[model samples]
Target: MVTKEVRLQSTVAGLTADGRVHTLSVWFILALRLMMGLAFFQSGLDKVLSGEFGAGGYLTGAVPDSGSPAADLFVAMGNTPWFVDFVNVAVPWGELLIGLGLLFGAFTRLAAFWGAFMMLLFYLGNWDVAHGYINGDFAYMLVFLSVAAFGAGRILGLDTYIEGYEIDGQPLVERYPWTRYILG
Candidate 1:
């Protein structure tokens, strides 16, 4: 087997960093995508099937009790009847759609973006700094971001075909450059 090396470089705040990635890293990236997809899909499916996933109590009670910095905001959202209603529907449906997108590698970046956002909220809402600042939610959020940055969808994913689809003698991505944000 041939070994391929991918060189990565980035500079932030006058600091430079670089690394080399082996081709074998692709499998791990794919695994992260599939793992998140399955976990979110199952969680959403259970919530949908049970028809009893309410965020109000946790937002108002648990968040405050956990001493999260965003407790006030969470409580405010919980107190709002309309917002609670919206959350009820949004949480399950959003997870379902996001999971589907990741699972099929369709609109993967979009899905990962939302997934990361959800994980951020979970990180804040759950608010457990007992051991340290880092937790599963934080780790999951980073994973989602990594998946998007790596364009994991291109690896045996529908995004590859979708991006290459012809449109007016040009590929879809070529026709609409903005698609790069969401397609991969």
Candidate 2:
């Protein structure tokens, strides 16, 4: 009987531990969202402020001996005038928006999805052969996917408020049907 009682006590302890973990996980995502958002925002700002920044140099340098398909895409796009022009503007603006969305916890999943996409490109573009260490992009991709999967914004974001938003005494859905994706 004592052994059965001990087992029951241990089971209760384990259940409580699991509950604590679930409760605390949101805070971790909140931290990730803030830090990642700031990092992306700063990178974009640096590019926007720099007068001589161009994607061509980086893209051209991505030529790889391993014959990565990603390398081929970068090399091909490096020379096109339109691609260069578009990338130069898009990189900064896209980073800024993604950062804002993540920081504010508005459209958290969509922003995280794009962030992961950008990280994938970075992962491919900067694959180092000599260095055995995994690149930062892989970590960033997982972080983004986690954020989206957990809906990190709801914990400490405008998203929670947006869900409760009322416009002119009408429900959020009444005012705009599309906001469900952004708010949720």
Candidate 3:
């Protein structure tokens, strides 16, 4: 746990149990969470809303014609019609849901996980874009992973309240590693 101190001009002063004032860069965190959520949500929404999604056009083009290095790998994964069709339909909507959840600080951790998973798929699908270290897909994946790990939603949104009452000091959270990963 981390603690911050806020000093008021008035004489009234209080300390958290950790002996520090409660303070955090809530604005900065909110900005980061919103941007991250929006980016992921938009990507997913674009995929689902567009007819291109589930059309298999991009997946097919992911081959040599698409110049994606991971074309062969994707081809292998796409062998299943279900997988191919699911990506087309599911990815975009999933992203949109994730974005909405993150935006509102609802189930933030789950959203982050889904976002990270989507990013992983993107990285795998667009390996051709991995031109050296600046692979945008990879970077996005990392960001999502970080969000999942850090519980970004609790920064300035409803998740903080959820954690304090519904989840705070719970045995499940204290004992289970995955519990903390959830938005609470």
Q: What overall lDDT goes with each candidate model?
A: 0.93, 0.77, 0.69
Cα displacement (angstroms), candidate 1, residue 173, comes to: 1.1
Quick one: ranking by lDDT, best first?
1, 2, 3
Best by lDDT: 1
Cand. 2 TM to true fold: 0.76
Write down the lDDT that model 3 would get.
Answer: 0.69
- After superposition, candidate 3 runs with Cα above 4 Å error: 1-26, 63-69, 129-131, 165-178
Model 3, residue 144: what's the lDDT?
70
Query: What is the per-residue lDDT of model 3 for residues 1-184, given as tens digits with 9 covering 90 to 100?
Result: 8554654342335733333333554565577678888886787777766657563656666554656667776776567688777776777788888898888887888888887787776776666553574577778777777666556777767777665553455644454556566773
Candidate 3 has its poorest 10 consecutive residues by lDDT at 15-24
Structure candidate 1, residue pairs in collision: none
The local distance difference test score of model 2 is: 0.77
Q: Cα deviation of 121 in candidate 3 (Å)? A: 1.6
Tens digit per residue, CA lDDT, model 2, 1-184: 2322121122454564222234456688799988888888888778778855688878877555444568878988887879998888888878888888888998887888889998888877877645654668778988988888767878779887776678899777558977655554
